[model samples]
Target: MLVPLTRQSFEQLIPVIATSSQYAYYWGKFPDFLKRLLISVVAVVVILLLKFLLGDGFDPLLFLLGIIAGLYWFWSPVYWASRRNIEIRRYKYSGFWQGRVLDVFVTEELIGTEENVNNRGELVIVENRERRLNVEVGDESGFTTLLQVPLRRTHKGIVPGQIAQMVVMSNQPDLSRIANKSDIYIPRLNIWVSDYPYVQRTVFSQVSRQLTQAEEDDYPANRVVKTRRRRR
Candidate 1:
């Protein structure tokens, strides 16, 4: 089922930024924390090098620039969060769509590697593997997509046939086709799975609740209409 979303709030973007930063290496890439640290270190090194070369002639503007760079590095997550929001807003319309979980399975995935030292003091590269849950979901529109997330203890209860919902954006107001990648939210598990944070989750949850309540209220009335037609 698809329900139109008429409102969105950016106030919850702080949590989205936090989640994205926390899962920076979700796709086996360099972690955001380490990346920011590296940037800060590089900026400091460059500033010191310029100071050493210029002796007493060093420009204070260089120092100010280095500080600005550091601030930008720290604020990168917020920048990305705002970009995601703008991307979502570019669509003519957006809606919440609930589909069924067609399949659920777990697979071992190599996330990265770590260095370990043996008793001999020799460093060895140890492979890091994580269990990932792959879920296939589809709706009546025949649109099917696979979502993968690192398997966690709390996610052990996810099974087939559960309701999975996502924010669907489209260039057309009717939302005939999806215009962007949306994070999947499993209402039953109360968990979200995605390569990146794409939706303002708090708003999504509120919309989901409203849609579910509306559906429940309409079911009996629709059933009564069907029964009356049969009697005729």
Candidate 2:
């Protein structure tokens, strides 16, 4: 099933910025507070270096830099949130597509390497491995894609035949060819698996209900038309 999205379908990103783990995850686990602190530290270091190199006459330039840094620190979160909102808005005309889970599998992924001290007091490189769950889904038109997430105890119940919905962006408004990646939502499990938080949950739930109702209403009519054709 495919349904076009409206302007209201998108939520204000600023309100949910702090609550989104996916946003923080994309920045290598740096939370908003940490980001502010890091930026402040770097700005101070740069100003001190400039003072050492240029001597006393560069006070005005250093003051300007400080103001810029302060403004950036204050508005950084809003800037990032706006960028994310724009990404989702690009797919608004492409419509939402619902597909069925064709298969489900788990794989071990090497996320990174950690340095650990062994019993002999020597640093050893330890590979950090994580279990990832992959769900293969496809629409009636045979368009398929894989949705992956970290395998957690909460995700153990996902299985084949579950409904997976996502915004399908395409150059053609008809969605003949996909253009970008989108967040996936599994309505049955109330689980959203995505690399980023692109969809507004409340709006998505309302749209999903409307689509399901339309499908239910069309079922009997479709069966009646088939029966009449058979009689003919």
Candidate 3:
């Protein structure tokens, strides 16, 4: 389901909006709400088992901290990678749009797992890669919105031009954004590849550039505030 960013639409939809629908495509249950609950229950069960096996000598406080850390390690990616209004950004509202891919590229990342008893359990090193795909789209006003979608997988055979669609949400003024899990529909291959869905394009490129520069015309001149801070 798609909802526009207009005030009236946002007002009417927030109450009825099944925020989980965005994630229902993957996790039939709630990823942020119910999923978290299940994870907590399981962690509690494991901790309980450990306490039983270790007997009265078990330190609940330390076990609680371990549980917290484990939860962080497990759910941080779910909460971070698929975050919505939780983070500060140019956009708060979500909608939908259709577009095409103008270019495609891949970013190789080494995703590995290591376990330890006395340290930050699993060490995660995300090697950032850029220049994945070029997507061309138009808004309701018919202005071109160009998006650069970073391919999340290896060896994604995306061409320079292809048909695709997205569920887009725009921020205020010159900025707008899409969802992170929203897939790029490739009609030719009848397949969807894991790639960046949170794309942004200024309503007017020149105007966006000017505002960016004017924002730098200050005591901190020439420095970016990095308002739309994203962490994986």
Model 1 C-alpha lDDT versus the unseen true structure = 0.67
User: Which should have the higher TM-score, number 1 or number 2?
Assistant: 2
- Number of the top TM-score candidate: 2
- TM-score of every candidate relative to the true structure: 0.67, 0.69, 0.37
All candidates: CA RMSD in angstroms?
10.0, 10.0, 14.9
lDDT of 1 by residue, 130-219 (tens): 777777888888988887877666666656666778877777778788776477887766788765666667777886776665443443
In model 3, residue pairs whose N, Cα or C atoms come closer than 3 Å (at least 3 residues apart or on different chains), thus clashing, are: 96-168, 102-160, 105-132
Candidates in order have lDDT scores of 0.67, 0.65, 0.43
Tell me which residue pairs clash in candidate 2: none
Residue 132 error for model 1, in Å? 1.0
Candidates arranged by lDDT, highest first: 1, 2, 3
